[model samples]
Target: MSTLQQLLREIDAKQKRINKQRPLEQTKIKNLKDYFKVGLTYASNALEGSSLTEIETKVVLEDGIAVGGKSLKDHLDAIGHGRAFDWMWELAKGVAISEEDVKKMHVLCFQPSEGEQAGEYRHVNVVITGSQHNDRLPSHEEVPALMNAWAVGLPEKRKNRHPVQYAAQLHQEFIVIHPFADGNGRVARLLLNHALISQGYPPVIISPVFKHEYIQALEQSHTKPENFTAYIAEQALQAQRDYIRLLRIE
Candidate 1:
């Protein structure tokens, strides 16, 4: 088997172990959700160049205290992402993803600051700053049809692959579509977690520390899909380990 496949198996084994510990207590679930809300909001926003530290993110979301020197846009990103994270949980309880659900998450992530463009697709063409790949995103005119096909095909995609692989593919595909003008990266991560959580796995946080490797893997995805899938599998495994240790599951 390939390295990516092996990593996927390891992730699957860890997820099975986590599954055996569930129907986790309600309080435990609440605590986990609260913890991840801050961590993920921080990491996801930071990857997109938000200046909010994890502590600041927690303070902003929990204490509602604005940090001095941080841009208003940065504060709004954290708050908007927090709301998007909560909406993710609600979507996780559903049977399948929809285009409307995806747009709603984007709206939540951007509405706090960019209210008008909240969930709207960009009318202009864009470029990824450091990518080696030259693939062009679908034009704005193409987004609605492309996204509809993406949402409609998800069930079939999930059936033939491991959940982590499915999530990774979904994420990569969403980025390729670049459906929204901004917040595509944040929405993509939220969508990825939605798939994983729906499958009974803990949500993975791709730390800012891995930002270069993460972007590079994505840049090389067309030529080397395993690199991207393996990166995601590694993060998923780490998430599972963290969850297991935090809950003290025997």
Candidate 2:
């Protein structure tokens, strides 16, 4: 097996053990797990060159209905129109970005015309506004090149950083760059999970239940490295806990 495949198998084994311990309803848990897996799969596949529109069409709509017939970008926006609310909802339920949110995330990740929308805070040079750190705002010209550079740079960074920290760093950098006119927060979270899943870590859910803490942790990324790292680490440990609970393993 390829290294990536082997690592995933190990992650699955770990997740299974965690799942066994939780007292969640079997059917509900199964559905939730399926949705989660589908969401992650969609993300990885898209990054691997799957068509975004095709992936969105397959994952977002329920009961065989097309929401929009636009290009991939437009379709993403149509699907993700109300993603901020959805993101908070999923986080409340101990899930991170869902397949639905992933579609939205794809739409809002990085737009080419966000030079003004992405105002840069002079303090730390990371892209966030007061009390709400969204995505990085780049010059329209800068967005495409940055993403291309990131695509090349991310793998090495992922390997070197602790999985949780790596995930947070990606999240931070995404926001710092503010690549989109909108959807920066949601996309950043999605990128965070992609980092984890790629490395065989369970999806780290930023529970909206912990929104206060979540925002606080992100805010600290400006000057407090340890604080930021701790926040992501705490979330990672929770995913490990939840997985262990679900699988009922020692």
Candidate 3:
């Protein structure tokens, strides 16, 4: 069997196991939610070159204490991302995604650093430093319509595809649009997680250690989109395994 097929099978098996335990204990839900708040904040920021460690991220979010030797922006990124992640959960209680949902997450994520432009699409074009294939982002003029279309089409997209594929499509398409002037990657990840969590899948954390591979997959998305889709499935399978461990599921 192909690797992607194997990963999807494993994911399906674990998801079935998890489904049998629906409505997990409140304590387990609370603990896992808190754990991922820090983990998602740290990893998402780290992928964008922030220097905060996972412990430091927790301290900033839980204790509001700033670590010395780290720039203020690092603390802001961590805290802001935590706020955004929380809002993602807020939206998870519902079934629809909207342009406002995407914009609001971006605003919360970047409000500390660039409040004025927080949720606003860029009026000026920009380039992603060091990127080659994935940098051919949509023109600034196209963002509004593209975003509207994406949000409008999601119900259909989710209806016909597997949850992992839907999330990957959601992630890849958002990155290609590059809607916001900054912090797009973090928000894209947030939306991806939102899509997964709403479908009862564990949130995928694209660790910084695999940032290169992740980016390469995204870059190749311009051509062989299946490669990127399969890469995302692999991440989802890993998350499923970890989630099962947390629940101590037999």
Candidate 4:
């Protein structure tokens, strides 16, 4: 069987357990596994294809590097804190971000440059997987169109589907488009949590701890079109586990 399909089956099985263990996630392995998945996904998105050894070193130092000096662990911690903060704040208000707000939020997140002050909002094209080779941007004009499709067709039924699924889809689509000069991953992650927070699920944290697996999933999606969905679904399942783990459940 294809890896993606295998992952799907695994996700469905895990989902059944997660639903049953809801509210009491900390007591069960099933719940812990799901939360672990969340930490992995956030780490994956933040530090895709990064090295763990380097991540640990920088993590110990607690220093934020502009572009390269930062390690995988640093990315994980940064994203985790950001997601948690947003999740808690949004939860208290009983509110969700609008599409307009998504764009503005992304702009704000991408504003800070290494040498510049915070809040610089990028207006240039972003290229992933090596900007030199994949320098093409997914037309800025098409961003809203694509986002609209994602917003409308996201997985998980309007009322029944886990909010994480929507957040995952939004993140994948945003990264695929490479919409900004910087902070695309961070923006995608923020949008991802917005969906989850709105739905009342704890924010998903993708840890740099699983950087390798995360990149492999994205690489599979980019190289094999038929497998992208499966890849994404699998990634989401893993992310669920990370979230549970962070909460110290199980």
Best by lDDT: 3
Give the candidates in order of lDDT, highest first: 3, 1, 2, 4
lDDT of 2 by residue, 116-149 (tens): 3332212232444565434434655676566556
lDDT of 2 at 107: 42
Better of 1 and 2 by lDDT: 1
| Location of the lowest summed lDDT over 10 successive residues in candidate 2 | 116-125
lDDT of 1 by residue, 109-177 (tens): 888588688888787777777666645667788988899899999999999888999999999999888
TM-score for every candidate vs. truth? 0.96, 0.53, 0.96, 0.55
Candidate 4 off by > 4 Å: 1-6, 24-97, 107-122, 129-136, 141-168, 193-204, 223-226, 239-250
Query: What lDDT tens digits, residue by residue, belong to model 3 across residues 110-175?
Result: 886897999999887878776775457888998899899989999999999889999999999998
In candidate 1, which residue pairs clash? none
Report the lDDT tens digits of candidate 4 across residue range 14-75.
Answer: 55655554566345644433343344333534474444333443343234343366564445
Alpha-carbon runs more than 4 Å astray in model 1: none
lDDT of 2 at 129: 50
Candidate lDDT scores, in order, read 0.89, 0.54, 0.90, 0.51
